[model samples]
Target: MPLLSADQLTIQRGDRALLRDFDLRLAAGELLHLRGANGIGKTSLLETLAGLRRPAAGQCRLADEAAGLHWLGHRNGLNLQLSAIDNLRFWCGINGASPAGIDAALAGVELPARARRRACRSLSAGQKRRSALARLLLQPRPVWLLDEPLDGLDAGGLALFAALTQAHLAQGGAVLMTSHQTLPAPLAARELIL
Candidate 1:
């Protein structure tokens, strides 16, 4: 069965139909990329899939429990006052996941041990982005909904994210993300243009 399915989904903003009768299905171990020009409802579609906003018409369904979905928006969702480790701990607690892998997750995102101790407010843009990406490692979910996940990432960060995404798919997880750039080699992804 598909992990997620949107049937004849319609979304509108102030009578302007961003998307009409759109449909999508994502199965386990699959990656779907949302591609389109700006103001074409890519973000809105992702937000609806993430359940952040209700669709104007139709509905999105998840085959599994809601807890299996992880939504990562354009914002990193990190607390600037907290250190990277602390941020991971807080998120893990909220997700009902253990914080024991905090250090390993930080390393996975290419965040050094020293930087992990520094407050998020002091980290650079790329570092902050990596810190946010570390949450994926700390809390493993079956479905990931990411919007502009590569926005602040550098070359190396992009590679790391690709590797993480590939590993997630290999583990039978699914990913739905929006990105302008093409995905890196070895990660087969389907494109959905809005």
Candidate 2:
């Protein structure tokens, strides 16, 4: 069975159809990239796959079912009032993941020294984005549903993110992401334009 699968998926928002007859499968270590024009429901699709939103039709099956997935939305899911470390802790707690290796996770995103610093209210846009990504490292999940993760990242940050993705895949994790920016090297991702 696929690590994650959505079969004949359909979703609607009020009178509008967001997705129709959509299907997807992610095997272990595979990465699927989703692309579409603005307002085409790419974010909505990811949300449904992550179980944050319900689909009007179709079935979603999590092969491991017990090991949950992580959903990173366009909003970055950061708290402006909390420190970067605190933010990581909060997401870990929510996901039932312990804070072990949290510092290393922050370091992986190049935020080691500033891990204890206040959040995005004082951080530059790129820093805020990196802090948000740090959650992926600290949290333990088998699948990732990332929406526009590369949005505000600089060239250097993008390079770091590419490496991070490679590492995640190497660990046999599955990823589904939507990005306007082409993913950096070592991803070997397949595209599905909504």
Best by lDDT: 1
The residue ranges of model 2 lying beyond 4 angstroms of the native Cα positions read none
lDDT of 1: 0.89
TM-score for predicted model 2 compared with the true structure: 0.94
Q: What is the lDDT of residue 47 in candidate 2?
A: 85
lDDT of 2 by residue, 1-194 (tens): 68899999998878899999888889889899999999999988888888888988998989988888878888899989988888888887887788887788778899648545765678877888888888887766789989888988888998998888888888989899999988887567988988
Candidates in order have lDDT scores of: 0.89, 0.85
Candidate 1, residues 1-194: lDDT per residue as tens digits? 98899999999888899999998999999999989999999989989988889999998999987557888888889999999999888998888888889888888899977899999999988899899998888876899999889887888888889999999999999999999887876677888887
State the displacement of the C-alpha of residue 139, model 1, in Å, after optimal TM-score superposition. Answer: 2.1
Model 2 per-residue lDDT at 39: 91
